[model samples]
Target: MREQIETADRRRLLSRLAGDYHVQTARRAATFMSRDIVTDMTILAITRANVRQITASPEPVAYTYEGVAGVPADGLRIPVSVYALAKDLGLPYENIRRRVKKLLDAGVCITVDGGVVIPGATVVRQSNLDLIAETQIATEKFVAEAGRFGVTAAQHYRPPTADLPKQIIRLAMNYFLDATTFTAKGMKVDVVAVLVLRAINMANISHVTHDPALAVTYAGMEEILPHEARQPTSVYSVGRFLHLPYETARRAVIRLEERGLVQRGPKGLFVSPDVVTRPDVLEGMLYLVALTEAYLKDLARVGIAYRPNPGSPG
Candidate 1:
């Protein structure tokens, strides 16, 4: 019998899984902020504001909308306009206009001089904080499980001692936002539809911890030529996962089918094989791989080898 993972190995695996969780939840958060559901463009707008915060001087700058006074120390405050955000994300003017209106009306965004901004009030709401706190709790549980497995950091590994979870979250948010922008422009598909595709495609690996067999089967399909991972998922499941309306998720999937990005499989819906090899899709894959690799590398600092089990999916 193969030896079980040691303490160090489990720790490393936990780190890698933590990286994966950050990416997944960041994508979910990007799509579903607060009670107000938003389109891809709106997601981009939020990301743009966050990016400003990430790159701002004086680390951990608090972000507040324009005209908001007395910003907190932790706020990475920045103002972003719909037009500029639209141009940056390659979204159409009209579409962004409509979405921005919806976002503002929903109090998820604030408007400023000929532009809009994500406000401190909105960001600091107890609900949002609770969500992040919940994510942290989940991450701790994951690490504890890893410890149980005797996983330890690699001998040469150096763990990031400062705000590691927050760092990972920031990285993940930027990655998914950039990827969505790329897909929207390259595939000529609405960002919302692309988001749906992403969620569907990810259903397989996302469930590995709960259902290892299912994950392996899905992984096997993905490994076969001309076959993508098969996820027989419904709009309700996708919508619930992304916090989108059922109809909205359904329509997005329909749009994806219309655009040939996905197909109706007997299993339900799967990404189209034809599009799997397309340059746009490949480019997106490369981007995702790069991001994950970087995260793994960071995990390696603390003695964790990046050895993933072939029998399981993540």
Candidate 2:
């Protein structure tokens, strides 16, 4: 079958999808997830807009040699217009935006002129009438390392499985957001239904299709199980996953277990099968289900392994 390449209209739709969470509800999610949902929503919108505007087509152009010919990997520097940079690299604007967002969050790209400016970002010269080829490659590499995604999940990452967990994670990250407890939030939504979403995202980013929710659940399992060792994940597991202290991971895991979204299986605590399969009782859960589905699908596409079985890495 022919692949559905991203069209302008599709890009527009994706932009909308990225920022669709409702205002009040997003606020609550922000509180629960750590980063303000409103802020993230705005970032989502801006990212889409910037990406759409800049990512249309990439072309190399001669540089006037502004501050520096190339952007430094470290230190702070504001970026130029999203459109101009994307064009200069001969790459898609979507790719540019994804990379910029990762760089921004990781403290790699600093915003200036409402976009990004890197001192040694790329090596371009006036004589060539284009950006140096190596510069574009470097920028892409930097972004890929930072875990960027596109409107479509399958095209999000290429050669994604080069590193198992990281590749899998980079693929699925679009859904992960900067949140602390997507798993718990998922329970209020339908864990089982979202499986389709994860599958679609996996197909999109990696061009590899699989069951969405189960893919993510499996991915979560991979995260908890290290190097094929399945220890009963404790609240400590949550903290470890979030890069926090043992207590924090424990607290959140316990909270979900108490809520009955998850439970201790014969092997370890697991997301309750009932919770995974059942529809959300809470009326507000619909939106969470949709958005979270989009996010996890993005993850699945990128080879983030998800083992549905407790302590199993699929």
Candidate 3:
């Protein structure tokens, strides 16, 4: 079993890297990284692709891979001939397999019979072409966003390969869709949403005295906005989104402002500047957004009216 897997992996590398690599070069590329992180990334991709299945596939199980490591919500692998899909995309079939597998291991996609399929989950597939095009589009969207964090795909390579761009975009899509950010404008948040929030927060906290609770809220502001807009970062709008009270909203904003999180400005409130520029800070902010979303969801579940206010945190 191990030999079959290794041989298959090697063959994939040869086919994908054929244009630039000799036989020896192919071997070198295969050894570039261990399979652990690669495997984790694959799992992430499979989980995203099979969003519903990873969650619990509505459809009956076709074939089951027992004791499947990194099995997602569905708990069944949607087997796909990823090599074939790469060919359809006109991508380097060999070059992208490792990446595809990484996604698989990470739970982004599942191996189905004919091809690895992006299951119908949060993302709708109008056509196979739509799926491919959308995936490509998702990749580009993420690259532009990552650039702000100095994590451009180009930075990792000297002259950046074609596969690098595509792979980065794929990874970006994963980072993006993981959020549950819903906007008041009846739209969805994307990379620009994060950037705008980061920038807005940075613009807001320039003058506020720091407080703890407010800091927590503003830190996650990037993930909660209605998209890129020049609006205040007070949770009242978010409270409005969650149908909270003016006091609940007011308290949330004041708390964040006290913590140097909600910076008041000529434009409106938003996150502090330092939160946007620093990656570690930005990550913390992302974590905050996630945490806030979960908390708000709990409030909504039972139709509770827990509106926040502009009260100072005790």
Better of 1 and 3 by TM-score: 1
Q: Could you give candidate 2's per-residue lDDT for residues 47-72 as a string of tens digits?
A: 33333323222221122234442222
lDDT of 1: 0.53
Per-residue lDDT of model 3, residues 1-314, tens digit only: 12331333222111111111111111121232222322222333444444344423222223323332222323343554556444323335674587776655754455666556544331221232243344444333322322222222231222223233223323333333233122201122222232233333433332221232332233222322221433354444444332335564455455555545446666456654453445544444335334323322322222211223213221
Error of 1 at 134 (Å): 3.8
Residue lDDT tens for model 1, 154-238:
3324434334444344444455566566667777886667668777755633454334344223232133223543446777877
For model 1, the superposed segments whose C-alpha errors exceed 4 Å read 1-23, 30-32, 35-44, 50-76, 105-107, 135-168, 204-222, 225-231, 272-275, 295-314
Top candidate, metric TM-score:
1
Q: Which sequence of candidate numbers ranks them by lDDT, best first?
A: 1, 3, 2
The candidate with the higher lDDT, 1 or 3, is 1
- Highest-lDDT candidate: 1
The lDDT, on a scale of 0 to 1, for candidate 3 is: 0.34
The lDDT of each candidate is: 0.53, 0.33, 0.34
Least accurate 10 contiguous residues by lDDT in model 1 = 1-10
Give the higher-TM-score candidate: 1 or 2: 1
